[model samples]
Target: MDGISDVAVGVKRGSDQLSTYKNTISGTDCMNDGASNGSDSKKLKVDAAPPSRVLHIRKVPSEVSDAELIALGLPFGKVTNILTLKGKNQAFLEMGTEEAAITMVNYYNSVPPSVRNMPIFIQYSNHKELKTDSSNQQTRAVLPAVSTVPSLSSDNQEAAGTSPVLRIVIDNLFYPVTLDVLQQIFSKFGTVMKIITFTKNNQFQALLQYSEPAHAQQAKQALDCQNIYNSCCTLHIDFSKLVNLNVKYNNDKSRDYTRPELPTGDGQHSLDSAVAAALRKDSSLLGALNPLSAAAVVAAGKVALAGQPGVLLVSNLNEEMVTPQSLFTFFGVYGDVQRVKILYNKKDSALVQMSDCNQAQLAMSHLNGQKMYGNVIRVTLSKHQTVALPRDGLDVQGLTKDYANSPLHRFKKPGSKNFQNIFPPSATLHLSNIPQNVTEDDLQLLFTNTGGTVKAFKFFQDHKMALIQMSTVEEAIQALIDLHNYSMGGNQHLRVSFSKSSI
Candidate 1:
């Protein structure tokens, strides 16, 4: 069963999900007010909005802002509306289309849940079958999920007498099995709701749930002996022992099942005094607020304190020691930062802002669990985030951009169509069968960030891929890692394997 949230974040958005969605369907500019229209008026239009594939997001980070969640959901396809229940750790997301949803479900299930520290969950949802009208609850166990689950006809919502619930015994579960990998396995047949696995005498076992009986049948038929994870050792699948073994226990939150915090996170952004003041203002930062780790305390009060809200704070830094530029220098490695500031006593910790909250979130995640310089830095979305003064200038000695614009002065055709146009001769990649969606602009963005200067970019007509030349191997490696598993408007992941050139 999927958990529902009843906590309203201020006045709840209206149920006009269709028009509200059509207005800001991309979720880019939700802050701007939009117009209203009658169903008849909308029907009068030429193209009616197409139905979107719905997604069920399980175990979303409680502190993730609605805006941040929307941005993260964009990779799946176009997001319509991201509805989160404030107190509830679950959410329901609807994607622009089913194809995009499929790609999202499969891809994100491999994301390891440790990106920025806060875990992200996405699976295909089959909410239609969560029937209500007095169905047998005993043998019929129902589940909900979003994106990339196996297909099923609407015929068997509830098997008349609630035959034995399919018992799926999963093997090869790593000592610390991850949610991402677990989702990838069970999402094959149906929505997987619960996983109960504990080691016995150095062996592991788990019970998986499927939304439909047909899904259980299909999974048994398709993956009975299939080697999961490319393992040669055959996995065991059993039928006829179909029965429900639901085990519920008190969650201790201290269990190691949670993903580890990133190595680089710390709240060194604030001064010492500010950390104390914010803790004084908000008493629960160091204490437990909701059974997760202690509320995060940021040293972000040193730069400038604005954008204050209700994120629990806990820290041990002197806010005055932090500077916006210092934190910017520390954080710029991740991506472009948009703002920074410190709050509390106006002298301690500062909240550093990034061009996107997703980047900031990613930074905060891994950084929260480590020590920096001398003190331990705790990083999480502050229930309250402060704003800092704008405008910036920084050192450029070690960066590649400074060198890209350096005085090589050997002027080639600025807009050359030469096969080796953009890159220098030495480091080149024979990217084959690249989808047409990968444009020169996208390639430039991909390569430039990795320290390569794309003097020229082109596409091949015969097989659809392009030949990219890099100035150095460092740049090429970065490009390969960052864009390795990319999807370009299709389900095909951007595969990056070594290729030997005929040259």
Candidate 2:
């Protein structure tokens, strides 16, 4: 079929005959114009060689193991052999057939491949096949005789009645995997509807549900046995027996993205507490906390005092320019700011109440020392548990504002990417949701009106997102405060946030 031989047929070609073949096949001939050293040693590079059974990958991360390299080819077809040139950070992967290699090259060309967050380039190699000495020790370790590729395609799964839920178990748990990490990785394939994580039988396990069974099958085919980190925290995924997951809470342990109004549970502790308890119970559970969980721990502090009360005292504001609405928009980046009350008598100070204790702690930790309206503001937990509203007849001059029902809350939805993208104010701002009609000049002029010099501007390839750098961090903050959620002549509202990247 399609001139592609089956893997079983390739295996019968005899490894002994293949081993005697020289390893002089050129991997970069397509790009280098047929130049070769005529030696086995070669530096693999991106090429546009004619379709073959082998593919060349460049810029591979040094820590990448054999399994990770194999995973790069598994989703497309059977990987019969692999050769990693660790010293050169390159690898040559041999698929079972030329058609499979062509499919892999096309798919990766569109999506790209990355290991440990480092982008790698892939292309077809001139070599029709790989011939490594089967007797070599390193070859034996990295090359498998034949990989058991999953034959369950989307069509097959649909006919078999596959479930939308996937059961995940993390083996070699050297890192604390949080719900946010899982969501970020899996959501790339589809819309993750819900997730629930817990430890069972002294092993960390999770149940994740996709919006469709096809999405689950695709994710399973891609991520099963893939390492979340360098060589640890490998994911072992399978179709769950249940058709769907029933998530009850929108907390660190479990989340339901479709149900944003769900409570964070009555007495739920942060994810760190659960991980720590598991570690105490089993010494083998020792591992480092990921950035998301570490940030949560640092924000919430000790488990005994993890409940930091949902009120914050913010001071040293530019009273003339500060308003409850401004504070709501600024602090909403971390969590939902429920109510904001600018103290009438002390116009320089205000009390901001968040949706919950965890949100308050997060807002305080991230915004404590940020600049606002030309003033370095200070944010700390207030003794008051909540911000009190004005009396019925008291004329507070609109200083006291309640935003409990505001539609601009960034973290209102569970498993939001915003939760992982929180950064301190910077000179660079990320602008998204731009209308197709909005041009660069329009955005440049809009920010210039805020009295800040637009140093540089860049629109992403899609044109819907961009990065604009201001003259200073304070200017960027002021621009963000003024222009965030501003309408751009269409139903779409502009989304602005401090970016860790620069144009």
Candidate 3:
């Protein structure tokens, strides 16, 4: 252990001060020459060797346990053997295959492995494998039992890269997908042990772990490239690199079912609160299948709409053209509009109420930055619990209106199909419920009359449904506001909403 002196002295000065920590310590002969040449000679040896099954790890803290070192290699592949040089503060790990070793090295090269918050170095070892006598007590102690290590067999790994965990990416996510939704969907196949949801590369992604690898494989096979709802919220699933997930909190973003007593963490609401609220309200807003029970829908709503209010404060409107009914119709594209109150003095501003917080959140997410009546509108959660009506005898240009019992509420019915087709506003609009007699030219003329350009149009195989692309999103918004529930001949009202697909 020639380099032992440098590392031992560096350890005293703290890991931050170790500038030569990146050097790879090879065999006995190199370690013998390492003290004199320092990092320069070791750096040459580091690049001289090609990929191998054994990886040489440097700057391993003496206090770090064998299990910690093994855990580092577990994510990449199986760790067959390990040999720790306590005096040199280094170790050599033997992966099950050379490919696994190369993957580990490449990954660590960018992310850089750390144990106990201390940075460590990993590179391919010159030796292909570690040779240790099976009779040696130390060697026996270092080898982990196959049962304890959750490594996939080579056959299973080659077949589908099977693991106990799945990585899920949600595409075209118009409606919020909560952790409870994921648990309910995956638990139908097996026991969902844990889940972690995050946003990466501008996409909503999740890591879910099942109690068994077979469960994960089944769920992946069934769910990959499938839509969570009728046509949107597509799920792209694959086997996660991780064999298991480490969930620290039982909150909306992450959960550990085995450890239910864990804290919800800061700024997070407990599942109990979400479930209690969901039970008291309608559960149709969550369109995902609930194999667990109605309670899962409640939990999904609570987590998805946590901290959101049922009322929205809208501002910067076109005062001359904006109206209570117009605001109700526009916002109703995303939720059931309950009430609307246009500020009498500030005509450009208004307060809109939805059936519940989930609806309000959905509306805000979609229409906050959207254009309305030739002006960009701003939508935010209102501090007021309810929009107060004007005095009984007094009327301010009839600005406020109550739609609590209005038949136009799209999400009023439980498990409404309307919940499944929600999408963010786009230039293309999905038009449905068209009168059979209404021709494409008639619809095009109607939308064009709204002072917007009609880019393209295509009727579905069933002429009752069609896609219309406008010159811009603003023009489409204007068309939707003007024509959503417009009366067609024979009492049929046209239905309009944003479409995820282009014509």
lDDT of 2 at 158: 63
| Local accuracy of candidate 1 as per-residue lDDT tens digits, 1-503 | 01111111110331222222233223221111111111112211223223236665545555654434433444333444455543335455555567656656655665444213445545555441222223323212211122224444455434412422333333332111322333344444454444433322222233444544566555554445433322221234443233343323212101111122212112222112432232234211121112221211111110011222323232444454455444443444333444555454444455655544434443453344333333466665664443434334432221112112312111223422221111211245546446766677776777787656655445667647776766643344445545554666566655442222322
Model 2 per-residue lDDT tens digits across residues 275-388: 334334432322333434211111101211333478889999999999999999888876789899999889999999988866676576556656898788888778787888
Q: What are the per-model C-alpha RMSD values against the true structure? A: 21.4, 22.9, 18.9
Error of 2 at 459 (Å): 0.6
Give the per-residue lDDT of model 3 (tens digit) for 205-232.
7778887787677666556665654455
Clashing pairs in 3: none
Overall local distance difference test of candidate 2: 0.68
Score residue 50 of candidate 3 by CA lDDT.
84
The ten-residue window of minimal lDDT in model 3 covers 1-10
Candidate closer to the true structure by lDDT (higher is better), 1 or 2:
2
lDDT of 1: 0.38
